[model samples]
Target chain A: MLDQLIYLFRRVFRNIRQSPVLCSAAVGTVAVALTILAFFSLIVINIQSLAAHWSEEIQIVAYLEREPSPARLKQWRDGIEAMPEVAAVRYVNQQEALRRFKSRLGSDSDLLEGFGAEILPASLEISLREQYRNRESAETVVGRLRQNPELAEFNYGQDWLERFEAFLELLRFGAVVLGFFLLFAALFIVANTIKLTLYARRDELEIMALVGATPWFIKVPFLLEGALQGALGAFLALGGSLALFQFFLRQGLVALLSVTGGDQIVFLDWQQQLLLIGTGILLGLVGSVLSLRKFVRI
Target chain B: MIHLYNVCKNYQKDAASALHNLNFKIAKGDFVYITGPSGAGKSTLLKLLYCAEKPSRGQILVNGKNITRMGSSHIPQLRRHTGIVFQDFKLLDNRTLFENVAFPLEVQGKKRFEISNKVYQALKHVGLHGKLQKYPLQLSGGEQQRVAIARALVVDPLILLADEPTGNLDLEVTLEIIELFKKANARGTTVLLATHDQEMIRRFPRRVIALENGQLVNDSAP
Candidate 1:
């Protein structure tokens, strides 16, 4: 068994070395396919992280009907702070609201000079707990807050959050569908590539069959070739992704993504990288097996 | 021993039969020749005996076991004890002569030293030991056939099947190949040589099974 294994390895290496062009074509096709996959994988990973981060930071601002007495303001703050969903609440007085509005007006502050503090409503800025940050949970919390008569209006940019969440869901679904299509496309490409290799050596394989070489003798070497091609392709893809990432970082374009505030896009972690490599190898093996089925009768 | 009872083969459905109702038997260590003109079912007969193509209509027995009923998975096991040399030489163009000859033993999972020693001996027996590293394309027609014979005999198989083993060689090379077959037969290997060269048959006669249009015409002893 060991002898056969050693010979099998020798034959696989020799077969690859004997036809470097065909072997390279197979590897190159796989590399190009996997690079596309890895690129999308990176985008999906970062977008998911960005979405989660933004969701955790969602805030709500509740405008007061009028400037409450100091005791009434304290009571309102205490009431909101006591809610299970409320993480923290900050009280913004009428003066502070007017100051903030003027600062935001910048060059137009002169237009706001005649405006009194009453023009800007005193509000309570509410931060929800992490668990209450999603669309459904935030809506539920807003429903609970609306029961208070002291609040004149509730503004949490809910429409923007809802749109963002919907868009994120669509993007995720699209990524999954696209990922599956790319995988099958890669499988087909690799299968045809391997079929070409099989055709090139059909006569040799026929001779092997004549000489009593088992089906496994013919199969193992080709399977190994597929796996090796997959690994090589994965390496090529990893290199391409890393090069692109470094280029983006060096150009200082990471901030333009607006996902992580200039933070560099993280490459696949060790486990993810391993999984990617394994997936590549599996694709190659499956492709080769499918291509080889028709030829390996004996 | 080998036996064929009413064996028949057709390459395609509704096509002419390649071999028709063939029946024969050869004892152990026998030397036999199957002869006829082109398309005489000479190659088809050898192919059937080696189990490359199934007999579409009857039974074949080797060593008293019904080979016609053998499963596809067990075909390799049957082939390991049987050697076949094709008319085209069938040597792998990409492999060295040594590798081609060593292939059979390697298939059996033989150790490196055993394969090396046995392949060397087989090549030496066929007078091609000095050209072990040469590829098939690099060798002459006679040399390639000799290498193929070495590959076949490397397994020390019980039955050696040759289909036009010397169809491409000149008279001198043909005699050399015949001598190699004679040597293998002397070693207790049953030899089946399929050919159309009557001159060689006249020169070295044995049991001749003649076929014409896929039917057995005559089975004669020299």
Candidate 2:
């Protein structure tokens, strides 16, 4: 068995050496395809991460019609906090709300000089649990909260959140569609490239068959060649993606996103990286199988 | 130890048969020549024995194994026991002589040390062990054919089938190649050489089986 493996390896490497140009072209095609996939995946991953971060910060604020008694305030807080989706509920008085507004103004607090605590309404801030932070759950909580008669108005950036959620859904759909198309295109191109290589070596293959080599013996080297190309191409694509990621980091795109409340941009995690490499290898194997099915006999 | 029973082969539907109702039997250790005109189905008969092409009708038995309806997967096993040499020399020009001769042994999944020993012995048998590293393209037509024969015989096949193996060589080289086949036959291998060279046949006579238009016209054995 070991001897056979050694022979097969020798044959695989020899084939690659004999047709370096064609093999390189095949590898390059895989690399280009995988690199494009990596870029799109990076975009989707970061966007989803940013969306999660924003969702965590979402809170429902119900403005009070008038100042309530201390007992009434406690009653409202206890009721809201008892809800399954509500993580916590805090009551902010008129004075405290004005103070928060001034703090948000930073150096421009003078713009609120003429305003007083009397103009601002006290509110109950309702923060949802982690699992309930999505648009649907938030809306469900809001619908239940609207039954309270003491609440005059509610604001949770509903319009912005809804649009953001819609955009995210569309982005996810686009990613899947685009990913399928890219993978199919890569498989087709790689199959054709390997087919060309097979044709170039058809004479050798015929000789191998003539010498009583089994079908597996003739096929295994080509399969190994395809797998090698896939692995090499995947690594090249990862390197290219890393280089592009570093280039963007150097250009301060990540810093700019951070300024807009986005989390730090991340490349594919280890699992995702493995998935890319695995896909590349699978692409090569399938391509070789497709070409071999029609080109080789016995 | 080969037998053909009313075997018939047609390459295409509604086309003339390549071989028709052919019946013959050759015992072990026989060196026979299949001689006929260009389209006399000499190659087709050899192809059938090696399981290269399935017969459209009838049966063939090599070493008591019926191979007429052999599956594609089993063809390789049949071929491993039967060595075939073609007219084109069928050598990988990019590979050296050692690699060429080692191919059959390697296909058999022999051990590394065993492959090396057998490849050297096979090359030595053909008097080309010293040129093991030479590429086929660098060698003369006769030398390349010798390398092919070495590759074929390296497996120690039970049967050696040669299809016009020396058609491209001169008289001297042709005789040299014929001698190699004779040597192989002397070592207990059943040799079936297909050719139309009457001079070579007359010079080194054997059991000649003549075919004309896909039918056995003569079998020169009482």
Candidate 3:
């Protein structure tokens, strides 16, 4: 077995050394496809993370009649926050609301002069926990708030909420679909390119078979070469994706789309980076296997 | 010893049989000739012996083991005990003569030193040991054939199967190769030479098997 291993290694090296062009062509196509996959995988991870954070920050506001009794407000607050899904609740008086609004606008006093501070009605601002941050959960809380006698009206950003829900669903669905196409493209590209290279050396393989080489003697080296190609291609893909991401950020490519801020355009974290490397390696190995399938005789 | 018991091989169209009920046997340490014209099933017979193609019916045995149902894995083992020299020479275009001759011993897991020694000895036996580093294309027709013979003999196989081993050689070179086959048989390696060289056969004949239209019509001692 040891001697066979040595001989197989020598044979693989000789083939590659003799046919450098063919080897590189196989390896190159695999790398290109893997890089595209790694890039999108990074996008999916960060989008998922940001979406989770968005759910936490999302909430609804329930405004009440002027100067509700402290006891009634307390009762309403307890009822709202006591629900199974509510995360937190806070009350803001109209005066406090007006003061906060004015502070935000900063000297745009003409619009406010026509209306008194009363225009800014106090409301109970309710925040949901991560689990209950979708439209149904928000609506459930609103329904409960409307039943309270002291509350005059309740409003949540319905358009924004629906859009958010749709966008999140779209990202997840798009990522999956994109991932499948990218993965297929990766495998197909690499497999065929490697096939072309292997086909060129069909004579060499036929000669090997004639010399009484056992099944393993022919398979192991090609498998090893495929593995090596995958590892190298995977590494190259990781680097390529990172470079592309940096370029995207510098060019502010996401700004042309619907996004919050540059801060939210998150880079790939540790988990994401690990996933990319794993993916790259997988593409590399799978591509080579597909290619070598027809090349190596049983 | 190799024995063909009514061996018959057939393909789709051209003939009902490439080799029809061919019965013969070549004993160990024997040198014999299979002399026939082209398309006379001489090549087909050699192909069957090496397990390259299966005999359509009847049993064929090598060293007392039947090869009609032998698995591909066993073909190499059977082949390890036998060597074949093709008319094309079948040397790797990029490999040197040394690598070509050393291939069989290497396949047998012989150590580097043993392989080098065996290959050198085989090459010397053919008187072309000095051209060890040259490629196949760099050598003349006769030299390339010698290299192939050296490769076949390096493992010291029990049987030597030569298919037109000297089809392209001139009179002088053909005599040299015939001498090589005789010497190999003298060393207890049975040789089966397939050829149409009537002049060579008349000069050095022990036994001859003549085939015409897939029938073995003659096997007479000279």
Candidate 4:
């Protein structure tokens, strides 16, 4: 069996060497299709990470109508912490809120020379659990907070964040559909490419069959051909995508995205990359098998 | 050993049968000739013996196995023990002569050293050992046919079936091809040669099973 496999491998390489044009056409098609898929997949992965980072930073500020005593503030903190949706609550006194504002203002801090700690509001900053970070759940939590008589004003950055999430969801859906189409295109192109190869060599295959060659003996070489094409295509796609990704990084896209306080863009992780390669190999094998169905019968 | 009983083969249900009900038997190591004119079902008979085409009716026993009812998976096993040479020489144009002859032994999954040794021996037997690296088109029609014969014989099959192997060769080349068959038969491989060349048939006398109009008309030994 090992000897037969060696012969099959040699035949596969011989076929490729004889028909370089067809093999390149096959590899190019797969590379283009897989590159498209990898591009969108990477986008989806990073966008999802960005979305989660923004959601985790979500918090609501409940300004108090009057400054409570330290013991009363502790009681309010304990009450908010008991709520299931509230992950944690911090009592930000007027002094602390003023200091946080000054830090945010950075170099413009001198412009606030006349401002006093009394001018800042003492508020309860509420952080919601992951499950309650969405717009509807946050609104529900805020509605109940508004019922508190001691609260003067409630503020949370929900409007723009909700819209951003909706846009991301739409983008994700489009990426998924596009990914499906790319995979289909890859399979179709590989199948036809291999079908042409099979047609060109039908005489040889017939002769092999005539000489008592088993179906596997005839099939293994073609299968190997397809797999090699697919893998090469996938690597080509990876190379192209990696180059494009590097281009984006060099152009300061990572800095641009990081300006909003989220981490820089990430490429596909090792596991996802492995999955993509596996998908490439599977597409080649399937395409070759589909093309061989009719010819093998002859 | 081979046996056929009431075997029928028809391509289409409404068309005339390619082979009508036929019955015959050839013992082990028997060299026989299936002689017929064009469209006499000579090729079809050879195909049936190798499990290429199933009989429309009746049964065929090749070495005591019911080939007519053999499963598709078992067909390869049946063929592994049989070798076939075609009229067109069916040589792979892109492969070297050595690769062409080495194909069958490779199919058997023999070791590389064994396959190399056997292929060399078979090519030597056909007197074309010096042209191992040559392609099919690079050689003459005679040389190509010799390569095909070497390919068939390299497997050392129990049964050798040839379908008008020398139909395109001249008298000199035709006799040379027959000499290879004579040598293979001498080594105890049962041979079945299909041809309409009466001159060649007269020169190399054997058991001749003559068919005409898809029916057996004679079986003679001279």
Judging by DockQ against the true structure, name the best candidate.
Answer: 1
Global lDDT of each candidate: 0.88, 0.90, 0.80, 0.87
Candidate 4 wrong stretches, greater than 4 Å: A1-8, A63-72, A84-123, A129-140, A143-155, A248-263
For candidate 2, write residues A23-123 as lDDT tens digits: 99999999999999998898888878878988899999999998899998888888889999999998899999999999999999999998899889999
User: Residue A234 lDDT in model 3?
Assistant: 72
Candidate 3, residues A133-193, lDDT tens digits: the string is 8789888888877777668887777788788778878988998899899878877876776
- TM-score of each model's B chain? 0.97, 0.98, 0.97, 0.98
- Per-model TM-score, in order, reads 0.93, 0.93, 0.87, 0.87
Per-residue lDDT tens digits of candidate 1, residues B1-222? 999999999999999999999999999999999999999999988888788888899999998888889998888988999989888999988789998999889878888899999999999999989988989999899999999999999999999999999999999999999999999999999999999999999999999999999999999998
Backbone clashes in model 3, listed as residue pairs: none
Which portions of model 2 show Cα errors greater than 4 Å? A95-120, A249-263
DockQ, prediction 4: 0.48
Backbone Cα, N, C clashes tallied per candidate: 0, 0, 0, 0
**What's the lDDT for candidate 1?**
0.88
Using DockQ as the yardstick, the better of models 2 and 4 is: 2
Q: Per-residue lDDT tens digits of candidate 1, residues A101-184? A: 889989898998777998888999999898888777667767877898888898877888878878888988998899899999
Q: Docking quality tier of candidate 2?
A: medium
In order of DockQ, best first, we have: 1, 2, 4, 3
Candidate achieving higher lDDT, 2 or 4:
2
Give the docking tier of candidate 3. Answer: acceptable
- Candidate 3 chain B has its poorest 10 consecutive residues by lDDT at B11-20
True C-alpha contacts between chains kept, each model in order: 0.81, 0.76, 0.33, 0.60
